[model samples]
Target chain A: MKHLSKVALLVAGVALAACSQPHLDGSGTGTGSGLGEAGSASDPTSVAYFNETIGDRVLFEVDQSTLSEQGRLVVLAQANWLLANSDFTAVIEGHADEQGTREYNLALGARRAAAVQELLVSQGVASNRLKTVSYGKERPLEVCSQEACYAQNRRSVTVLTAGLSS
Target chain B: MKKLAASLLIGLCAFGAMAQLAKAQSGPLRIEITDGVIEPLPYAVPDLVAETPGSNQIAKDMARVIAADLNGTGLFREIPAKAHISTITHFGSPVQFADWKAINAQALITGGVSVSGNELEVKFRVFDVFAGQELGNGLRFKGTTDGWRRMAHKVADAVYSRITGEGGYFDSRVVFVSETGPKNDRKKRLAIMDYDGANLQYLTDSSSIVLAPRFSPTGDRVLYTSYETGFPQVYVLNVGSAQRRVLSNQSGTMSFAPRFSPDGKSVVMSVTEGGNTDLYKMAIGGGKRVRLTSTPSIETAPSFSPDGSQIVFESDRSGSPQLYIMSANGGEAKRISFGQGRYGTPVWSPRGDLIAFTKQNKGRFHIGVMRTDGSDERLLTASFLDEGPTWAPNGRVIMFTRETRGSDGVSALYSVDVSGRNLKRVEVTGGGSDPAWSPLQ
Candidate 1:
């Protein structure tokens, strides 16, 4: 009975997706196979876009807010995306693992968000378009008792909002 | 001569029978010991009676969990089920005194679970096993199936209180931040659960982040930090009604690490204005704010003494975060931590004797306690990172967060006695952090 219900839900989801986008290629055909993508060809300063959106969140190592190279790359991609789309304002939310003190974690979360904000500004994004907040270790996407869950719990996220057009 | 020998043998048999009768007539076992000595009372938890299918498993699990909770405190030693000679099949059955006495059990607990229309009814009785008398009448708790674990905790609380003459913390609740995602981009939400980490209910939907929720003296209100207004600000939440209002609204400034005064009339917290953080106090009813610290250095983690006469806090004015003490009325604060490490989060014991703090040194974190006069420093538990020490009401134990290190680290709640004994991990479904113990209810 459970399997039958799951199959019905899957069919319903596929039908909804098909109904929503009739103009797009339905057979998983590649559109950006040419010499340049649409936006980059129009704008000379536009950088290559990576599909890795930073999940609108950032996480920190236990007791530390220093960003890793992967985290920096995500922030750079976000910065470039924001730079290309000049009307966007973002809020950086910092988070810590469940390991450290609450007050310290809050401070560390702020520091992580601040680090992302600094990097974005350094990458030519406007300072006024950025705000920072720290959630500390209050929210977890995964609820488990072991290390996998804890590792996932420490993060920072970037949220976009409407701002003045460049 | 043969007749004489036979008569002597009969006399020996009669003597043996008399001795047996005398032993049976003696009163139940009782033990008395002075305070300040470490002695554990022996206790037995027999398998609980089940009234329906799967009820037996529920009863057994509940009994075992309760026993573990009690024994983990180091105040009681479980007299293994193998030693429990008599089976407790019902709540009202007369206990077999001889069987319990034979195993040297000082106390015994018997409970039963009944299911009625999706509601669970748990009934429990605590007995002075040695005295062959019931310590208290059987207690019955009725709640939903999800509340069965809490019912078990309530039973443990009753038994613990009856035995120790001190309030049990089992029936309490903890408000902490639940973590997820990666170390770089984690989502946080305000979550609450039973003190044993059961019935985890998320208060906020992670739409905005929250942190460090402390229960009020009455346990009806919670004070915590939230970024809903685009900055870290303290908020008061009425747990029963789920209504929330901002506690501090100082424009453009940051406020965090809030704790309620013992009288519940005011909250003490850390406020950052300009680049300096200091401690401040404000009425819970939203009134005039009073500055508690006037320094250029970081002063955070302010906790009230039991009587609300003094405040213990952590300050980095001395170049490192160390414990400090000041009058509740605000005066020159004196440093109270002289230990060899940086101390933070100094929480005064509810008994008004010592202050529990988190000490970090030599790449390790420790939960430690010290006298009010900067003496008698004792580290209770050492770990990769242990912080946020909150005192149990009796001042006999301290609960803090412990994090283990690896590529993928873990965080969990841990408790330790003041004497540096009986360290145990608190079980929770997901990882837990920033545990603020509530006052004895």
Candidate 2:
């Protein structure tokens, strides 16, 4: 009960902080003075900020690896975040919806990951700081066997890891 | 007559003196399984007469396994033990043909079991009830007490071959991906089991994802894809030792769908480099990889012909995935699947006469078989999701993965006869998919 109350208090505090900084919601206009409190959405260079504010993933059409207009924008934002956060390296995980054979899905996932890597490299993100892995259809963000869930499952996620200076 | 000669040759090779004498005395009793929708041949397998104390339970269980094996084929129907009018009390007992024929049983199998310590000896004889004569000489299989199921399978294989004129597949094993957990976070491990889903052993843990395990032609090793390195790569595992080594480990590429050549000396698999997937062959002993297909489109799931001369693979180079045939080495290829549906996972039959594949059409999936030239395409099964077909060693059956639809959907192993009869789920613990039947062992 004590730990729960403490978590509630922390949530309330974070809510108050977010309400005060309404203009810092990934608008790229905030002063670069919030990097000290890393690992929070309020901190511009944190992983959580990159994941929620900048968007660390992109979805693909059925049986396609070509990026959409929105997906390209997301990748472009992700590339910018990676360029700013030099201490962090990224592992781009490729995935596919469970509508194809296992082997084909693996290849498809690889293609999707490669597409994201290409975009990031084109945007000045160092190629050496990025690695790619295809999870195929083995992992899914959604489990329902419908277009709604499949669209979410067919995605590539950019996961960031710290302390990889190389 | 040529087919019959081949059958007799197989029977003679399996059951030496008895088949020769039976070939001379009377017309042979045969069940042509290919002839569509015939009545199930009625057969009776009495519990083997226990020749030693404490052997009665093993005797009954062994006969049960044998009966189940034969009945599972969809070609034979068992005349239940309760329906038997005459029971043989001794292994040397004479014909009860009149009683079996009265029950309309065309075939009768009688056996005896003797147990000593852990050593078990089982002997059985098959009789053509209508002909009032033995179909072949009595045969015996010796094994440990723990291997009673295999001994029974040996009996069933012999009886099935004698009747169906095809090599028995009952004595084989299958390597497959055993699955667990829920849909989004499912965990998979490599598992091996007997053809009838017994004696299961895990070849790998569920710590990492594994898929599509294919047995070596000799059944001593297995090839499968694993994400141990966080990238999909092919690995070869020794079935006996549980030792595994990564086979394809280029830094920036991913490889999967590996199958052994007929000689088991080389493997052909799909490898992805720079977003383009193509088929490549590599030696089992580690050598330079040979590129077989250089198409810009995805090409994977390559299966070798029984003769190891040609390879049949699924490629989407022509817009949608279709079956194609090309030389084992790099060369020009000819498209074989021209059907409306998309075809993938084209596995050549061990007999070299048919290619089995997974087809998706009109919002449904099917397990289908076609001739080498892609003619005479026969869809064996249709479901919400059915894919990754592996042929039985005899080429008379195909086992594949079938998954249900929904958020709670799960995958399981199922098999069907080549004639599309006897579609049944294999009784596996937990869930399973991607079955690769080893050659008859």
For model 2 chain B, give the 10-residue run with minimal summed lDDT. B1-10
Model 2 interface DockQ: 0.19
Model 1 lDDT tens row, A35-76: 232233335333223222233445456555667888888888
- Give the distance in Å from residue B133's predicted Cα in candidate 2 to where it truly belongs: 0.7
Which candidate leads the pack in DockQ? 2
Query: Model 1 segments beyond 4 Å from truth?
Result: A1-101, A104-166, B1-40, B48-65, B80-83, B89-93, B111-125, B131-151
lDDT of 2 by residue, B252-331 (tens): 78889999999999999999987889999999987889999987899999999999999999898998889999999969
Q: Any idea what lDDT model 2 has?
A: 0.84
Can you give the DockQ of every candidate in the order shown?
A: 0.07, 0.19
What lDDT would each prediction earn against the true structure?
0.69, 0.84
Clashes of each: 40, 0
Query: Whose TM-score is greatest here?
Result: 2
Task: Kindly give the stretch of ten consecutive residues in candidate 1 chain B with the minimal lDDT sum.
Answer: B3-12
TM-score of each: 0.68, 0.90
Top candidate on lDDT is: 2
